[model samples]
Target: MKRLKIKSFLGTAVLAFLIASCTDILNEEPRSVYEPGFFETEEGVRGGLTSMYAHLRYIYGNAYFYNTTQTGTDEATYAQSADQNFLVMDISGRGDITPETSRADVLWGNSFNNINTANGIIENGETVGISDALIAEARFFRAFDYFMLVQTFGGVPLDLGAGELAFNDNPVRVSSRNTVPEVYTQAIFPDLLQAVNDLPDNPRITGGVTKTVARLYLAKAYLTFGWWLQNPNNIPTYPETSRSDPDGNDAQWYFQQAYDVATTAIDNPGPFALQDTYYDVNWAPNDRNSEILLYADHTETSEYYNDSSLTYANGGGADNFAVWMMTWNYTVLRSSSSNTEWLGDIESVRREAVQPLGRPWIRMSPTIGAITNTFDDKTNDSRYDGTFTTVYRSNIDVEPAISGPVYNANGMEVAGGDPILTFLDEEPATPIDYSLPPEQGANVGAGVLPGRPDFVIGPNDISRRVYPGLWKLGVYRTDSGNGLGQPNAASTRPFNIAKFSELYFIAAEAAVKGATGSRSARELINVIRARAGMWRWDNSENEERIEDNSAEMVAATPSIIDIDYILEERSREYFGEGYRWYDLIRTQKWEEVAGSYEIAGDNYGDHTPQTVTRSIQPYHYLRPIPQGQLDALDMSAAEKDTYQNPGY
Candidate 1:
């Protein structure tokens, strides 16, 4: 049981990664015998393990990975930044991703680098004198990296440490891609199996990876292998699809294995459970709840993200990464800035402008069309409004009292003026007939009717529009004092990686795929619903279960189960928690899943209409290997040709 104070320890790992120079330079792929002796020591082995886990920071700490996984799916789109042109790659076929794509490069480089480190520990396990538990931990980390690689860039070089390469050339030169199935069978499965056998049921430290986490990953790996085995998706790459069954991979068998492994993790009862309410899941200050299975712990000292140059000066940390997914930065009609005359009280004005949650970087936008229509029952679904902010209070006094100043539609300082605040849903009929406009000085932007002395505060001009701001992860400070060094740069929000609610979705999906039979899909989904206060399960949990609940509540009995029902249930439970894209990808519903949405105003809703049409392409199943890696490959053109992902 070693203490895993791996936060500051990760700094060493980050330093090890020289900024990947897209073409000629790649992240370090250790020379065979350069540091062999160091890994032979007990302390060295521990350091190696910590550093290996530390590479995950490059993945979770930045918005790149999150956006790579989320944006362009039916769930969300990246903001239209003047410089962020690559943002188009997520949703539309506009961007032809290549080796130079920064996202692809970091993911490919860091994943392999971590795996290479894990290989060092695993290869020197006996000499290092580290216990079996440590070895198991290392193996899980390696398998986890491969899982990401295979999912992103199909078959990557399946390199396990060879204490010394048979040929002493460059190590990463083997950018030779393997088939999708090969990465799984060779690296993911064997490594996870080693992890399952050697790791303890739970780790000694909080935030440390546990055997349960390893097992869950194993289940997902198997599920992925099984699903990808049949070539269900990847239609554009038809005959040459990366098939595995013919290469001795059993599709059905792995599905069952996925279910079995997931079941074991699910029934483990090791302090993890679903929070009774969705809000409680992201409610900071309570991050160590039962719902979160694995997360990158962020502190000011050991920050998850540290590159804020993307949004503002001094604004890069794991907290800022969460802000990237937020709808926080809309101050177009925010009371503090929107109010010039100060007609409304301070509190009401503040409430009208800001949603009081999530500092909106608006870098990534969640679509309003999807928000209104995605839910199975928009009215009954608690997540519909709870997850998105559509209605906003008006900061200005839209309607005046009897003695208030009256002005025509134009604000001409009439004696009676109405308070200029109302719900977007219940907007005033006559263009907010403000006879006298609130005197916002010329510097401030206000509305005035043409040729009319009585100026009007028109809704069309102000930033008050009915769009959904993502509030799934709550707000950090939205000002320059955002605590991440820059004002309104990043927050103290911890980025969530996995949750128990997802486990339920995994189980239900596994069940739907004919893998598990422990619970019907309805029963599993009903458990989540009862927690969200959406709908109660039929069979109520015992009094004891209720006492230990997220809100001290329990589920009732279940009903008939089906796949469609489970999918929608997932939307209700884990809307913006970074699960949508992967879910659609795995379910083979990308085409119908990502309806082409022309977001006119803003991803955070600047009162613009959104257009959604089915927009998934067959070639999207696998992202292209970053061209930088391909150019760096010592292999021939033919080799590179075969190695690039299909259709790329």
Candidate 2:
């Protein structure tokens, strides 16, 4: 009776097919290939489904896609490191991404691996009495791959059947990349709608696709597509430009479709439900709960480890989702400076393990505002607390050195190794509040709230005091509170790619955009708000207010249904579960929100000023086609040139 950890199933017998060892991604098979009749039996179908999941896992499980999603977005503060390639991609900003840049190559070249495998299953599912359920599962994954591809690269090669690659007897691989709309029409929609239509009534399939998963993805696809229809310039050219009218006609229809599908998923009452506690969706005991519709399934035993022998440097434990997001280079490490005398290990109390629960990458820094006021009921909104650690506990392997001339928490110069430290949970929850708290009220700047600065922090700026550590995935050594079982203690936790609360936002967005769903935008949103422990606002109030806990519990509510308000709610709920970048892109707020990433540090103590802008451009909307793939395409020079995305 062990929990089926989403990352625990890496090495089991049947699912071994999920692990692909060779660099030869999508164009061909994995280390092991399923020969001809593999899809004919129940076992085979299940295997096929696992293989597809494995391929999908390759993209989301680690930092690749996650890092790309945050960079310049409002949801992230740059944690620029020289070695992390993807971080540089985010740092590169708008026009700087040449075809030579690796961003497109990694995403584009490998994604097809998912698409082609799903194709193999769909085309041959019926051969060995594969149930309609299994067929639908295959289609659901295929749709999932295309949806991501279109969003990432404007238009990509859409292969519904065994791609043109299989047809040629001779092997000079050449293929045409489809236009974005063509992808939506020819691949994404056909597969998703069919999966939705064919899936059985049940939604509980344990790492496999279910009826609700398909519909949720369908709703998402239509919603993202609707954005392009309204603002064609947001994307490059799509083949079906005729269908996207400037008038509200086509855009409204797409919005309605998104609304309809998301509403059905919500109203149907499938296994997916908003968990009473927001953090449960990502942590154990409930990582595999109903709230998560789409996720990479793993089991407790199948732990991914970073084996040095493996060809890939970051080997083995590919299952862990936290590695890509965490930045736990202890701020306590004191380095020696050249040409300057020891100058007494200078100022600042040791925040040795200020955020010891998880190794934070410090990449996705919530803006001072996001940490403080994004939620009207900041305290009640369990999401803020669930997603981040506002406090630092005294938990680290090394004690601060008893150096002279260093100021501790009290800003006093004590020389001996001060063995004392405080553990504060949700300290300074009035995080970055715009209205400064009363001088005497709420213990202003006390304890860790006013602790010393973090040493040598992010590559983006390299030094700073503290920002709340993203604790959503910070299950340090399974929360043992020490790095003891770390290094290979399971890194893979339940990573939710899609959640039930999103349906509420989808319905809300659709309603605000002029498409009515099964419920009013306010009503749909209220359900999510209530679960997060928020309060409702009076419709005509000059400003929002709850009962101030003077009375029994209540939920804080927004005055009206507007997209900006909805966006903030989404930020509060979905934080680091990985949707910030796309959410901004779809909403056309990328420029305004994540406009310029900043990098400023060198000497950042509690108040020595931090932040300097990084590059971001409008055309950054679509990532470039991986130059390697475009160069590798089996097409004419002109055709290949056409295949590369607009700028890069």
Candidate 3:
């Protein structure tokens, strides 16, 4: 019943001892050592369960890990300020993604730690008379982590140090991996099945594991494993094994199971349902809504609970700063106090801790395909308006501490709350002049539309240095009394991990892969498209906009639905949310979908779009094992080479 609460008691868990606190240098070593006796008590089991939820922070909201998931795909590419950390992941000529640079290490390290903690709870909690329902949460998380690991890095180890799926008290230097089939049949599928059978229909605590949540993961795992078995593209898997399932089921069988489980969850959603409109779903004030099945939680209430200061965050590890990457330096936008000649430039749009504006790192930018192609229906669909910050208004009241009218586009007088800049939804009939120099009042290289009061850039003119910021994932805080508040602070809003809408997607995708269901794939996708067409508020215009274009949206669906259509819908629904790479990988359409992209150069007025090709090799499907993992191994170089995935 609590609003956006991750039970406060999770902070008390002895995670340091359970994870065997390691130095930053050797953090990848899976040498977790929890005292077997601690988890033998009810309190200890509860603490371990809480720690499993807490572990999500290490990966979900991490910006670098975020890059690994998004940059190479069609949804996003490296921006102007991107460094080796981000550029390498783009795979568009910056460099190869080496083991040392791959941020998949975040998942590799944190998931193992959480998996071991889950192992301790599962092994010892039964001795203390812990309830099966309580222990099922551990099983859910253990399976959840293995699912993520297998998707990112093929054939990950199920046995950390002890026997297969057993708790290890002592650290071990050597390790071995389970094949994809073993990981699914032995670890992911079995654990999730138990979790679905035992977890409560409703969460015992806020954001706790539930039957619906377990079913979602179980369904997703089945779907992913089916894709692996099909191997339609013949993508190689390391520590190689035949595609034959241990349970003797074919890919189509697994696909059918996935569809059945997903549709079952969709039918019996417990305390979870889709938000009425797409705007309400990602609205900062409306976070932690029913649509979110799981999230990595942060709070504005206390720094101790937030894991970083709510007042300020330097965009480091464990902070929910992933939103900062796609944010451009909108604060650089300027206006003048004069109509004709250039008077002193005034900061019109200052940074604020609001949904549209946040700390700008400019490390990643959405690909042009994301803006113009994926979200082509800007008028009929509310999703395009809901997803991007296309308009910037003057905020003299918040920053610059000024009081007077300023002149923006066409030397028009503007007050606070007036539009300063706007990314035009589509190319205009009137030309946007990019020839004007910055000193001549064309600040930040933004072109001015004749007779308009706001600087405007058409879709084609969106450069690497200037583009629409991701509005859905932007920062929001209640404490910014009158000024900018804590614009630099990590967002207190929970980083959503799973959503109820995904059940529809999972089921739809499974159905496309040869699973017949009561509902057709088109019907399932239309459910989401209809919701996306409903608009309660306009993000760009910043005003109340009550409109229901659901009929038009549904009518616009193709006569037949396929994988490509499903993927396009996914991008529109979940852009810039770290879902692109995996979605493409699951369908084996990464290379075909994201083989090349187009974006302009990274200067203020540079708007010449150039196509850049990506070198997406088959081995790129699986990320290399992190260098830290290889260094921690007490094995020979040849053995380590054999241990690592090929083409690293």
Candidate 4:
């Protein structure tokens, strides 16, 4: 297989036609005009493989289907749909999902498209005497797509071989949803193992799949299987009637496998390493730093390649959907040239004044306890700096000087603004008064509170006004070097988050599961905490806080070890990366913790506490398989009965 010399056969007319139709059909179909003979050579195999890769890019880049669904219910974005039904049922809390509204159909379809492409490549490549290594890469890609499918939708239609002509007419969809464990053991694991065996440890190709990539995928599959299927921790098993019958212990085992694979990848030649400074390498557009172990390498000329210019709001590129989804919040506000000082006074503003900068909306709100408890110790954590805004300004300083002409609702400068001026001892210096309206005198911003404005008020003066319309996550770039003078400044001003610090938390969890040392989990957790600039356990304040050191704390703290701590760390680390909802569900904490926070001013009109309680029901554990596929299936009574997971 390695010795096979694949050749390229490009018939002139056929090749010309492919070139003509290439741009349009590249994403949808590649085989409509080309015959099997066209793919007989090495160059042809490369083109076919490249086509498969294009599908892979599409698979990952479907931000709306994947990121929105994940972030909507997960941790970052609170569902603010105007429809109460959509907010309460589809998001906010888990509820029975109608197949019609569910987005699983898109995930299923997109994944299978990649799988089908992989199948074509594998089958045709073999016939053309393509090397075993190429075949292995194809297999890895196929297995990965399937893994995503099975995890998401339970038993998806398994298409190991190429679809037959009759597949459309008399399609035979596989019955009996493969058990999660069975899928891991039979399909996912074998394919990955074979891929690892057949692929080079470090291939000559710069960006193609390698053994390390295969290991990473395999490890993740094993870890997930261990947790959901094996239930190593002896936690309550997911009932057979559940959408995906998962065993808690199996989940633990899968996590361990993930750690092992990550460890191996770390130890491999040209091993994975953390980027030195979170701000410099990870956040910068520069890719020279190759801390990324496995990533899609898109050259500057490649359509998939994204640069700072491509991501900039004024650069005619779409704002990163991930950044937009993660950052959109009613309480966040953008600063404008008209109000430079307003940026400093976001802490005292009301929810109405907060306007989010246009970006992918990714959010994960840490519990108040989570924030306060970790605050002092983690004051220096790179993540803390990257994730939250700490500065604030007082309202008194933000009020416009009395000397400035006051502008009314219609923007006309009004004469003689109220001049009692009890707040300041000196007469107002400016004619305009930008004081807060009387209706909103006492509201505080989400994170900070404002103090007295710059004006020196009379000793008896107690009135305080805050600057409104402050956006958190407020980083931005000006349109021109002339600063805020540019007309496009406000309109084109955009801020989107790309690199998040929470992946480190996930890596820590994986490490703990795969640890060989006596305190491997603790060590891994501690390393992450340290990276986050959290205080050591021996710190005086932390010691005092841990006076009782309950098992949960002890387990989470360095003194003791528990998975719960891992979960909590994950919650903190990945707060706005859209992992919260999934983490909560996986750890069985959603119902218990969902109602703790009051809905301050949700988009859905005034939902009462009674309306927001989320109880963990078995049905919600797995989203229902899309109904469209079910409609197409020809099912006998027993087969249909046995196939669908119980709750759905």
Best by TM-score: 3
CA lDDT for candidate 1: 0.53
lDDT per residue for candidate 2 within 1-648, as digits (tens), equals: 222112211211101122352211112222245543554455545555656655544556556556667655666654424234444555443225567754444455445655555665666677767777777887888778778878877766553223531211122345556666778877788788999889876753465567777888888888888887787445345323454533344777888998998889887855667765555555454566778776654433223322111111242234444443544333443322211332223322233222234343444344444544553354455565556554333222234333334433323333333322221222234342213221211111222233432211211221222444565665433333432334333244545577777887887888888887458887777777666653333111212434333111124465577887778878888776678878887877776665543333322233223444556666677777766665555578887777666655
Best model per lDDT: 3
Instruction: Give lDDT tens digits, candidate 4, residues 324-344.
Output: 322323233221122322322
State residue 487's C-alpha deviation in candidate 1, in Å. Answer: 4.6
The digit string of per-residue lDDT tens for model 1 on 1-648 reads: 323332221111211222211100112222222244556666656666655644555566456666766677766776645124335555454454554553656566566556666766776777757788887888888888888877776666663223221111124444345566666777888889888878776655566667778888888887777777655655543225446564464777787888788778878847677766555576555666877877654433222223223233243322335444545333344222222343322222222112233354556665544554565343334455456544333223422222333332233333211222222322335453323323342112333344443222222322212234565555443332412223244444456777766666666667777775767665666667666653321111101212223222223323555655665667666777667766676667767667676555532223345464544567777777777666766678987777776666
Worst 10 residues of 2 by lDDT: 8-17
State the displacement of the C-alpha of residue 200, model 2, in Å, after optimal TM-score superposition.
2.7
TM-score of 4: 0.62
Which regions of candidate 1 fall more than 4 Å away from where they truly are? 1-36, 90-94, 160-172, 233-242, 246-249, 301-320, 334-359, 376-380, 389-466, 475-489, 534-562, 602-615
Q: Give per-residue CA lDDT, model 3, range 49-100, as digits (tens).
A: 7667777876888899999999999989999999999999999889889999
Give me the displacement of residue 307 in model 2, in angstroms: 9.8
- Tell me how far candidate 1 lies from the true structure as C-alpha RMSD in angstroms: 8.7
Q: TM-score for each prediction?
A: 0.75, 0.75, 0.95, 0.62
Whole-model alpha-carbon lDDT for candidate 2? 0.53
Residue 93, model 1: Cα distance from true site in angstroms:
6.3
Predicted structure 3: lDDT? 0.85
Candidate rank order under lDDT: 3, 2, 1, 4
